[model samples]
Target chain A: QQPVQSPQAVILREGEDAVINCSSSKALYSVHWYRQKHGEAPVFLMILLKGGEQKGHDKISASFNEKKQQSSLYLTASQLSYSGTYFCIEGGSNYKLTFGKGTLLTVNP
Target chain B: EPEVTQTPSHQVTQMGQEVILRCVPISNHLYFYWYRQILGQKVEFLVSFYNNEISEKSEIFDDQFSVERPDGSNFTLKIRSTKLEDSAMYFCASNLDREPRAFFGQGTRLTVV
Candidate 1:
């Protein structure tokens, strides 16, 4: 099943911070975060395994909580390049991914 | 950096016609997948291929849809008889393994008229 993402859309000024959350009903082996710009492919941001580890990329970071079957993505000091749609994909036991509806993040100058 | 490449950035075909979308994943990546996004919709997984066969497939992948690794370097998705609903951006992706990040192609905009 597809996960649920909170805050369907968010607007931020450059250097602002935002958080997007994803929650799933089923247990996830891993959670993958991706950013997609208009008319472009989704780019891999980071992957968080089930061990409750947190991973970061530049000003973006994510935490996965296995017990609650949830993951949160943090964007700090956002940049103009950060404007895009963020998708959280849950990996099942079979390794197939089910993506969320996506959160649209717009970072203004 | 290695990236997955897809062919025919845009394709337009009449309903009921067959269409094939091709992709070349990063070399040495063992796991391949096909996903699609209807205009303005979220990405949906279609199938995953490994070891020269489909490892898992979603309901979206039915009798009319099939995938093949025709050659060592190419992965393809074939729709035997397309429908209007099949019109979407088809993305091909691949990863090194089960837990690694999957890289996606720019996607082929399939317009079924």
Candidate 2:
């Protein structure tokens, strides 16, 4: 099944902060994060393994909670370039990925 | 700096016709995948290939859709008979191994009429 992402859309000003979360009911082997610009393909951000580790890109960071089957992405001091749609794909033991509906983020200056 | 590359950035074909989207994954990557996104829809995985064979596939990857590693450098997705619903952005991706960080191509914008 696809993971569930919170806050269908978020609006923020430059330098503001926001958090997007994804949760799944199945046992997850990995959680992947990607950002898609308008009318473009999704760009890879980072991946979190089952070991409950976190990865980051500049001010964008993510955490995976192995026990909770949840992951959270944090965007701090956001920039206008950060405005885009964020998607989380959950990979379970089966090695197949189910993606969420996505969270649309708009960061304005 | 290596990234996945796809050809025919945009393709328009009539229904019942066949279409083949090509991709060249990172030179050293062993795992390849095909995914599609219907307009305004979430990206859906079609299939994954490893060891020159399909490792996993989704129900969407029915008989109409097939993937092949035709040669040492090319991976292709062939849609035997195009349908209007097949109009979407088809993306090719590759990974270093079983790792979750997948590098995606610029995508082929398939428009079936």
Clashes of each: 0, 0
Model 1, A21-67: lDDT tens digits are 99988777789999999988998898888667898978899999857
By DockQ, the best candidate is 1
Per-residue error at A21 for model 2, in Å?
Answer: 0.6
Evaluate all candidate structures by whole-model CA lDDT and list the values in order: 0.92, 0.89
lDDT of 1: 0.92
Q: What TM-score does prediction 1 earn? A: 0.95
For candidate 2, give the lDDT. Answer: 0.89
lDDT of 2 at B74: 98
Alpha-carbon RMSD, each predicted model = 1.4, 1.5
> Cα deviation of A82 in candidate 1 (Å)?
0.7
lDDT of 2 by residue, B14-40 (tens): 999999999999999988889999988
Candidate 2 lDDT over residue span A21-93, tens digit each: 9998866778988999977889879888855788897999999995748999999999999999999888654
Candidates 1 onward: DockQ, in order: 0.75, 0.63
